[model samples]
Target: MIVRPRMHWLRMLFVWRGSVVPRILPRLGFFLALACLAVATGPHPFNLREGPLGLLGVALAIFLGFRNSTAYDRFWEARKLWGSLMIVSRSFMRQALTHPSPALSLEERREVTDLLRALAVSLNHQLRGTSVPLDALDSGVRERVVAAEHRPARVVLGLAEWVARLRHQGRLGEVLVTSFDDNLDRLSEVLGGCERIAGTPIPYVYSVMLHRTVYLYILLLPFALTGSLGWSTPLVSVFVAYTFIALDTVTAELEDPFGTEPNDLPLDAMTRAIERSVMDLAGEPLPPPLLPDKDFVLT
Candidate 1:
């Protein structure tokens, strides 16, 4: 994610690191060249008349706007789920560490805390389709989780088994068990949410339709404007192309919020935050927060 201070509107005009312009520059240049060709060729029988473009522009804008909104909604929802994951991970550790229970030893509490930390890292791995970073796992935790069918979900089930064992030993009363279970359920819910987003993409048909429409409009637009704008067609057409192009690119990046792209959710940073929170509760020194790049992009 591109983390930055709020820039003045004027400064934002020159901001490049966080903008979509870089990604779409190739397409923008292509359309700019097309605009120049249309102008140089002057009028032609096949030239698109500018008079009929207004209605089509409005309709296209509406479709693009809706598509962009849908993508942002998915991005925001994924962020929220990760946020909740952090909360629940900490809460579970807190309960295991501080709750009064003669039957639960310090070692048992530590084991549960380690599990919480491993779960946080594993779930992030699952979302990103990557293996758990070795540094994120404590000794032995990695090897055991490697064989699980779904590493993150299995860690959660491992948590459930721990609870069952504690309850069986009468170390946890029904009331105490309920609280821990509640937070475990929250963790499960968060994992399920992230999985849903990662697995179920916006329908391919909708994406293809919007993608083709944006390109077609931008490519054909220069033809319409060149007749009236003449030599200035490249300037006006490139500006128009940039708007449509930028929006389309931004939407595509955001649609998969778990990606490592500059604009996607900062899953690495968020996962580190969860690790730190769990460590604090485990009575370990918290690691430093992950910093963004020089350009203010974290992950």
Candidate 2:
């Protein structure tokens, strides 16, 4: 995600790297050429009226607004799920470390903490459809988790088993174990929610339909306006095309918030945060927090 400090209003106009303007520039240029051609050919060759096109623009704006809203809802919901994951992980670790009758051995504490760390890394990879590195896992379950079909789910199960073992060893009472179980369930929900977003996307047909309509509108716009605006058709048409095409491109990126795009959620930074938080709770050296790049983007 782009995480830059606020810029001056004038500087904002020229900013390029993280904005969608760069992505739509080629399309805007194409529209500009078409608009120039329309001007050369004289007015309304196809008898397309500005009135209908104006109404179409309004309708398109409404649809684009709706799609953008829906896509942002998915993006925000994903961020919240990750936030919940962080909270539940810390609570689970605090309970495991402080609630038992006798303090857990340092080795046992490391084992459980590593599982939580592994779970976070695995989930990050799973969402992006990338491989989980074996080195990112705990030694005890590294091979098993790497070999599993769903790495995050397997790590979640490992957590439950560890809690059950503690209960059997008389380290935790029924009530305390139940509390642990509840947090584990929250972890599982976080995993499931991420999977849902990654597996299912905004309906392909709806997106394609809107995409086609947007281009079609932009293509016909110059012809409609040339008769009225004449020499200024290219400027107006290209500006209108920029607005529609840019919005469409942005919504497409937000629809899959787990991607490595400039505007997508910063999964790498978030996973690192999970690691730092878990290590701090385990009384181990914490890794440094991730920072955005010079371009103000966090992957």
Candidate 3:
């Protein structure tokens, strides 16, 4: 989410801020020095320590590697889910535009387009935890759509109801009704997918264990390396801490793709894009694209 110039690796690192290490390392550094001091001033500072130290180092390496991989997977999965939403939303708009509805009145056609626009805005507000005011639309339409707790679903179901009404009134053929129904099903699937990602979370136990292990590893690292690395323990500790912290931060940001975080998928922009596309299909003037202000996009 912290966008930098393609060549600016150092800036990217700084922007990430090494979520875990910067927070835990100072305390660990103090404890590590205390441990080293205890051994250095003790009579048997060089007692058989190589075996445990070597084993711990290997274990920490493996654990950090696995944690980073898991975090990356979560991040990528969230991206793919949002990508799916984009595709499905576009397809729904296309179907609405292409399916012939010759018997629709001018007012009815306008209402359908407005409903789609409202759906996009409602979904954006729902995902971002923003309020969608009833005053945003005409009084009758606003009351009908805003009555439901799930605004997006209400908008979608309203579309389905409209299609059904048209069919019953002989305004649309059965085939056209079925086609719209298919599009509605796809929309529902997309809504369910987003809800799944939002509601589910990485296990708390995994997070707690990872935190404890990283802290313990950093604490023990200085003692393990002090004899060989000497006064350079702090420097090495910082590097190791950064590795774990960066992974943890990336994971936390990616876990909720719908959030307003700088790194999160730009759901607001996506919703607007959907609105623009739908409006364009309906022969309305397109809204301007949402542009990123600086290096970082909304996502």
Candidate 4:
């Protein structure tokens, strides 16, 4: 999330806001002291063979590479799923706007448009754990809508019920209701998918085991390399620790895509865009889009 130039050495060192060093430094320091003592107090310590250290380095490289790749795959998958949800949400809004309902009066059509806007806003608020603005609804409708636990889905189902009632009253034809139902189903699918991602996470035990493995590997690395690398052990340890720890950090942050972390997908901006589009469909003056920050952060 914190973008920096490729050649910025200072930023690169501190890019993850010191997250890497804290996890890496303690073990690294201990190893450095141990390596130094082993070299200074003993003869031929620096003449150690490189075969075991080389093999360990190779193994660490492979493990870090695989871990980082798998974590990146999960992160990208989450982004793709949310992107699809946005597209489907927009498609449902478009359908609601253009789908013909011949028997509705202009006022009734306007009410339907309003309902669509409300649905978008409510869903946005619901997903983000914000309050729904019920003052915009009629008193009886407002009370009923507010009483529901899942306000967004309630509003959506309420719209479907309205459509069904209209059909029963001969004000909406079967074909139009069916089309509307299809859009509703799409919306439901989108909601369900988002919920699935938000609710489920990579298991805690797996994460804990991976984290412990990475750390233990890093901790033992210097022991294997100390005699061979000597004074260069600290520098080598830092580099090696950086790779393993950074990979672990990446996975930890990315595993939960809906979190408020800077690295997470821009869900707030996404919801606002959906709200603006739905309101535009209602013929209302659109609210401004949420702008990216100077540092490229999105709310």
Candidate 5:
């Protein structure tokens, strides 16, 4: 989501907009203060055996690494699902345009195209638990779909009904209907995938355990290092804390990629892209594509 010109070495370190540094800064400062206090207060060796602390740091690093990997998997899977939506919509256009069907009138073709666009928009809204944008659909179809419990599912059902009507009218043969139905089914699967991601979360215990361990390790690190590092402990402690805390924050954000955070998936841009692609394939005048804002964030 953070889109900008490549930065030089110094600028990259201080870049704040998209990084998790801001969120974790307060914690880092607190640890730095603890480090200074430990050194100024005669640095009580904390009697804290360095051996145990070193071992714990190693174990904690492994755990956080695994946690990040799992969260990234979820984020990547979500992105692929949205990509599938776009692919299926484009495929629908190809088959619908080529199908020989008098029952599939021009108006109905446009209606079905809008339905596909609305399905994309509806899924975006649904995952965020926001109201369906009736504006994304035609008045009549919107009225019916908005009344349904699942807006996206309703739109897809309408599409299937349109296909069924075509087949019944002898405009579409079995082969054409089957092809259209396959795309429709895939749309359902994509919607279900998004719902699964939104409804189910990484286990609460895993997060709790990591959260506790991270802060505990950060807070105790200064005491362990102050004996030898002396006044320099604050600088080194803050740097180390920054990496661990920032990584944790990144994982937390990636765990829910549907969010509006800068790092989250650009659902707004994606849905609009679907609309433009659908419009272009249908021979309609194209709308302007969505662009990143001044901050270089898309959503």
Candidate 6:
């Protein structure tokens, strides 16, 4: 996501591109209009007392906090899994380059490296529900992996089979094969962890409940405060509404970290990093890192 440099507190307050303000502005405007109406009507027939509303706001904050925590947990765990994926990939590539006996030919070495590269790209696409980029795969590797149902798993299998072939040929000893297998297993775990996060989300009922309560609270807030706050009702109510609604919007974005949202994880950039790391180990000229956009969003 957003990768902007730190700004002064006052400048931070006015930062627009990465903030949730744009998404919730309409909702805040609606609250402002509703508050003005409550003031104009004098809270005549329906004055919601602040006592109950104050209690409700406190409870709402707690729930929002819980949900935000849960969403951030998912986002952080996904990032960690990708981190592990990168580490394991580098280790695997190092082994492929150094361990095999009768040393692998240029073609064989490229095959191994391409599979490593494809694993990251395929996993990135799989998580985001997008197609694998053709340019990322060699023609030969692409032919084999493209037909598979799970491209990442298929790429991993290719790696495993290569290791098996080495063992059968007496090129790789049992101990070396075991080391390769351990790293391969770690790669599989990374895949499984990413899948679990992508497949299972925070329960929808909680989201719906909080969404309704936040809006309804903002709706009734003006009526609750208009009697006392009078002319200041619109300003105060809209400001309050911004906090709850902005948190709600941000949690929604963070909950799906694989998404293309400005706040979501930068899967493309991460995949590129994995590629560069592997290429560097292979002694190839490394590709440039993916730069963030003008808005400082990486993907």
Q: What is the descending lDDT order?
A: 6, 2, 5, 1, 3, 4
lDDT of 5 by residue, 92-207 (tens): 87787779555356687688788888888888998877877667567878887788888899988988887887788888898888999899999999989999998888999999
- Name the TM-score of candidate 1: 0.95
Predicted candidate 5: what Cα RMSD to the true structure? 1.4
Better of 1 and 4 by lDDT: 1
Clash pairs, candidate 6, are none
- Judged by lDDT, which candidate is best? 6
What's the CA RMSD of model 1 in angstroms?
1.6
Question: If both were scored by lDDT, which would come out higher, candidate 5 or candidate 6?
Answer: 6
Per-residue accuracy of model 3 over 184-218 as CA lDDT, tens digit each: 88778767776776777777787788778777766
TM-score of each: 0.95, 0.98, 0.81, 0.75, 0.96, 0.98
Question: Clashing residue pairs in candidate 3, if any?
Answer: none
Task: Score candidate 4 by TM-score against the native.
Answer: 0.75
Q: Per-residue lDDT for 1-299 in model 6, tens only?
A: 99988889999889999798888788778888888988998847864699999999999999999999999999999999999999999999989989998888988888888899999999999999998985756788998889899999999999999999999999999899999999999999999999999999999999999999999999888898988899998999988999899999999999999999999999999999999999888877787999999889999
Q: In order, what lDDT does every prediction score? A: 0.83, 0.91, 0.68, 0.64, 0.86, 0.92
Tens digit of per-residue lDDT, candidate 1, span 181-291: 898889889888888999998899988988888788778888888777888889998998888778878888999999988999988888788878887877778879999
Model 2 CA lDDT for position 113: 86
Please give the range of 10 consecutive residues that has the lowest summed lDDT in model 4.
13-22
lDDT, candidate 4, at 284: 65
lDDT, candidate 4, 1-299, per-residue tens: 43334647776555543254555567657656655565465444345455765675687667657656665666677566656555655665565556545544556545555565566566656655778875754555566567888776776787787677777777656777887788778667756765666567766676777777767666555555666666676677667666767677766766666665566666667766766766576666676887767655675
Better of 4 and 5 by TM-score: 5
